[model samples]
Target chain A: MYSSLILLPFLSVIALNLPFRNLMKKLAFVVCLLVLLVQISLIVCPSICIWSNDLDIFGSFLQFNFAVDNLSRVMLFCIGIVLLAALFVQRYIIDDEERIFNFVNVLLLILIGMDGIVMVRDIFSLYIFLEITAVGSFILIGFNKDVDAFEAAFKYIILSVVATVLMLSSIALLLIVSGSTSFSSISDALKTSPDSLLISSAVAIFLCACFIKAGLIPFHGWLADTYSAAPAAVSVLLAGIVTKTVGAYTLIRIVNSVFGFESSINSLLLVIGIISIVIGALAALGQRDFKRMLAYSSISQVGYIILGLGCGTTLGLAGAVFHLFNHSIFKTLLFVNSAAVELETGTTDMNGLSGLSKKMPFTAMTSVVASLSAAGIPPLSGFWSKLIIIMALWMSGFYVYAVIAILASVLTLAYFLSLQRMVFFGRLKEDSANIKEAGLGLMFPALILALIIVAVGLFFPFIINTFILPAGNILGG
Target chain B: MRLFWSYGLFISILCIIGFYCILVTYNLIRALVGLEILIKAATLLIIVAGYITGHEALAQSLVITLIVIEAVVITVAVGIVLGIRSHNNSLDARKIRNLKG
Candidate 1:
């Protein structure tokens, strides 16, 4: 089951770019549709293996291994939704068919990496997927050929390469310890960790590598610049799903499932989480660009997930996973909305213009809704998740962390409101009047995201049960 | 015995030199060279660790695989760096400020 759900995306991605370049959009849509169908099948059938062979050559033949659990199924579903929506709306951003083909192909490669990362059961294979995603984005970031795009792409490359090297070395150490690259076998080897000193140092180095990729407080230098400089679609994808899958998701998987999420590690993660929140929020609050602010916001929000993991309570784990899902939805929506506004208005700078609400009402309103969801207002997706996390914090006997969490929420609201006011509400600048709404290509992603935001807000219990609970149960309870 | 000790100490010192190169240099090309040094040291350390621990499979496979991946990564990275330099005439990261606030 996991094999089909995961492998099909990659195969279809390559397949979509073959001789039938004219039908690229239809091909991508079909691929997403198929993947979604398979993902849904997991609910009932739950495990399908397309390539299963008990007969091994002992060590001669190259092997392909994959399986999809509830965790991967959830991530695959999110990837499908975003990919389909992006495909649906992509045409609006381009008039050149040639450009569309290139863009769609790149998007599929990214989707392939995301699917591969989640389903991969081998650490070496996971590293390959991680590098593919990072390098793929590094190339995509400079797609615009603009000055900032080139610079952002360069910085992101250097930082990601360093992190990847660190990760590889740690994996090397892990291989020496375990003698196997597969996660199942590595888990068994980890059980034989006979020395405390080695375990402590190895775990620390591994966590450092993960933290760099995850952009926890001190290692977040590349995030904001990269987000602002990348194209709108790419920005939405990065903000929505990229960091969560490669960085946070991997960290959670390794520490909680692989390394056993011990108390010392748990406490260590809590410190990182708290610092990420305070520092990310303070940095975000000073941002003048809307997308850069959201990038910083992603750093702070990632802190919440870490905090939830650190608490090691069932509720905390559930809240964390739930927030992971919720953040992907609204944050992607926020980026898509920003993309729409930038497309119509010709600028993303807060100081550039105003009176957007009068001209681009839909874009303005969607931005407002997405921002509200991001800030954790009542009756939205963000609210329920934030409420659960703060409650989890209190339940864990960390009142100080809980208070800081609330303060961060308010701080979040403060910057977003500043963004909201400066971008949408004021009188129209002289040249701002002719700005138009984004066409279907760009607006479609935002529209779906907007509806889903309100839908998740209104029907909280259903989401909590279907998506969050199963994954939460797996994480802890 | 001197050969063994000298080779080990030499590689370790080279590793430290590489890291310093990364820290003090703002040129992207130089930093890339620094990272190459760091990875080389790491590979050496891994081999030594494996030998000390008597994990032969890990020692051999790791040293081989790290060398291959690092080579490919460096190739692609240098190509991109050259592309950047062609456009801007500078490989110094400090001079590149188009992406900042």
Candidate 2:
């Protein structure tokens, strides 16, 4: 069953590359639906088909390394649902028909890679899976073949290359010192090996690369442009999980499970986290483009997650995980809303839109909801998560950072509320008067995400207590 | 003693040259060549590190692996640079300031 989760996407990719492009799109959707259902069922009962303990790929002694644990369950579930919805939405929104076919193919390949990353326990396998994800994204970004898209994709490729080189070099250094790249073995080696300059230095460099990939403060220059230039759904992917699961999620795991977070690294994390949150929010304040704002917002939100992780308490980790989930849900909605406006209004500039609520009610309502959530306004999912992260920071005795976080949330509210007034509160522009609500195809997914955003807020504990708490425990343990 | 000192000098100068070329280049393609230089320098450093510890034979394969990975990276970098130059009409990063924060 676990293998199927990884393989199904590959099959869909093959289907996508077939001559029948329209049929391939529909078929890919169906396969992903099946995969999602299978995953949910596996969560219900994880004992159906066990992955073998031994199977090697590329000459390494590969193990099954697959388990439907609580952490992966949430990610797989979210990724599955989001991919399905995004696929449906893309069928119509994507401009170039030929590119759409190519994209769906790469989409499935990226999904397979993500599934592999989530399931594989070996560090080397994780690296391989991450490389596939990176390459897949590079193709997706460059899909449009226009100047802006190409420029953005080029920057993304360069950054990813630098980051990859740093990461791979560190991996080599690690293997030289540790003799194994399996997480299980590395965990044991970490426990036994005397903390020496070689291992520590290698680990530090690897962590830096992860930070760059995650787009935290110092390394976030490439994120906004790349995201703003990509098509809507592709931007959604970048904002949602590519950074979360591959970068932040792994950071949590390695810090808690392997490196022991209370040492020097934890302090560095706190400093970086605070820097990212403040800088990201301030940067967003100056953005004119709608998607560009969300990009900065992503960086800011990710900063909160890092700050929560930096707090070095179980509550903080729990808050971080919850915020991570919540951000993915709302950010996708926000980006999709912007996409809709751009699709109809033909521009993503805030100045180009006016009193849009009267024109595209569904889009307007959903955008307001997402904006509210992001601002951490009460009764929205973002509020509770922010509240928890702030509380965690305060509890951990980082009063200054806690204050900065509060101010950042206020800053978020200020920019977002102004955005609301500018885009939805004034007179409807003649240019946007003919704009209409997105079809059931696009609105449905946005609605689902909006519903999740609100529902998670109302029933915040149910999610946290059940899924996130355990995941946090695993990370914190 | 003189022979040992000469060998260390040779390797260090090679590594330094590689680092210099990478840092001084302005064009993206030239920067990539610099990256190759650095990769060579790094491999040399790795081998020397191994030699200092008397683990040279055991570390050759890993060094070889490093060189191979660098080759792949350099090729990809060059290809992507080509595409970027076509898109932007220039490889100079100074004019590519459209993506600032």
lDDT, candidate 1, A1-477, per-residue tens:
345554555666778767776777545555655655555455445444533433233212324456566666667767766655555545566556666656666776776678788877788778877877776676667666666777777677677777776776667667667766788777778887785654566678778878888888888888888899888777877777887888888887787667776788888888899899888988888888878888998999999888888887777777787788778888887787787777887778878857888888888888889889889997888899888888988998989888988998898898888888888898988876568777766667778888887898899998888777677676432
TM-score for chain A, candidates 1 onward in order = 0.90, 0.92
Residue-level error in angstroms, candidate 1, position A361? 1.1
Q: How well does candidate 2 match the true structure in TM-score terms?
A: 0.87
lDDT of 1 at A324: 82
lDDT of each residue in A252-290, candidate 2, tens digit only? 766665566665787889888988988899888888888
| Model 2 misplacement above 4 A | A15-29, A32-64, A95-97, A475-477, B1-24, B35-79, B88-90
Instruction: Return the TM-score for candidate 1, rounded to 2 decimals.
Output: 0.89
**DockQ per model, Cα:** 0.44, 0.28
